[model samples]
Target: MISGILAYRNIQNSILNGVKIPHSTSQPLIFGENGKYYLAVFVFFFSREDIEKGLVERPTMWAVADIETGKIIEIRQTKNKEFSDASYKIKYNVRADAQYDTSKKYYEKAFAILDSCRNEIINTDRFNPEEYKHYLDMIVANIPKEYQRFYFDLSV
Candidate 1:
């Protein structure tokens, strides 16, 4: 049985090894529901130096990995057009202003929970959509209301 954490790690490593171009970092969002696992990563194609210099308008890649059968069922990347220059500017301001510190802390907590429970999520013999949905609902209930919408938008 492939646990959610194992699935996340499997896909994350795949993206690190198979990305089309050399990437500096990958910030991942992982979720498990309906007896399935999802791994989503926002890939930044910037060097450490570029980020240090405050360049936030670079192109970003979205990688989604669907894990099943203890393997990656699907892995794909989508170029997000909504992250335009204006969006980057907003992101830069948000980072510099520290207004999202609370949000960041919450997200980090969620990630920690998922990351720490790898061994507990045993692999199942078959996919169970209802079971996953139930688990997903529980996960969603724990998130702050402000970030619930964003969490639901992750469809990978």
Candidate 2:
């Protein structure tokens, strides 16, 4: 419960910090794995400097990993069109002006959780909805009945 909220709050911070959270507002990030429920929130993309410094470059996707089950799913794909200069400018404006209310501690905690679960996320260069759905179906089928309601809300 606590960690889930923390993750959401951290993503909210990213939005306020001039970065898109990368998911929709109509849903609560949801997953069931290893007998647990996880709510994911997308963090920001690496800056040009950070990219040049070898931290990260050319990030065009997002992820929400199930820490317990070691299943990390890329939540969305940002096509070149989706992030074109014009679109980026729009998102950037929103992010820059958005108010961030989460605390420092929340960001740290969310980072820790994501880092710990990093290994679970299988890397790929592109975002394919069909492929994501195959994985999503597999994971969804494995979730216990009690969590079905949550998944229903999260399904696109």
Candidate 3:
């Protein structure tokens, strides 16, 4: 059985590897439902100038992944309705303060988007329970002994 954290890390790494973008930030959110693990990795694109200005751009792309197999299920480049408006305008003496405020809003939006995606996946019957279990078993069999202790059994 793989620990939840380990699964999350693997899923995040897989998404990051699949989507390559320089000077971008990512936030990966994980959740399990009906014996299946799913992840939505949101990637925010920004340039050096944007960072200097303490701007937090909306997520340009996002990928959905199967945590059990550490594979991307889908990638979306379309903008969501929540972020259709222009970003918030704020000024601060400290760059970090401005970044914090903007980043907080971006993360909140990311969470909302993930929740929406999760609802869709759960309601649409997108996952197969048997297949999820098979992938879990495969992960357990392949994981090294040294790493086993760190990963709690998910089967419990």
Task: Please report, in order, the local distance difference test score of every candidate based on alpha carbons.
Answer: 0.45, 0.38, 0.45
Angstrom error of the Cα, residue 78, model 2: value is 2.6
lDDT, candidate 1, equals: 0.45
When 2 and 3 are scored with TM-score, the better candidate is: 3
Question: lDDT, candidate 2, residue 4?
Answer: 38
Inter-residue clash pairs, candidate 3: none
- Ranking the candidates on TM-score from highest down gives 1, 3, 2
Model 2 lDDT at residue 12: 47
Model 3 lDDT tens row, 35-97:
665664555566667667665455556666674443668766635422123232432111332
- Model 3 residue runs over 4 Å out of place are 16-20, 31-37, 79-95, 98-156
Residue lDDT tens for model 1, 21-40: 54533333454446555555
Of the two candidates 1 and 2, the one with more favorable TM-score, higher being better, is: 1
Pairs clashing within candidate 1: 1-123, 2-123, 33-132, 34-132, 35-132
Local error of candidate 1 at residue 9 (angstroms): 2.4
Error of 2 at 116 (Å): 21
For each predicted model, how many residue pairs clash, with residues at least 3 apart or on different chains? 5, 0, 0
- Per-residue lDDT, model 1, residue 5, is 48
Q: Write the per-residue lDDT of candidate 2 for residues 33-146, one digit (tens) a residue.
A: 344445443334555564344333232444454533324444555562122122233222112223433565754554444433332332332234454354344433433333
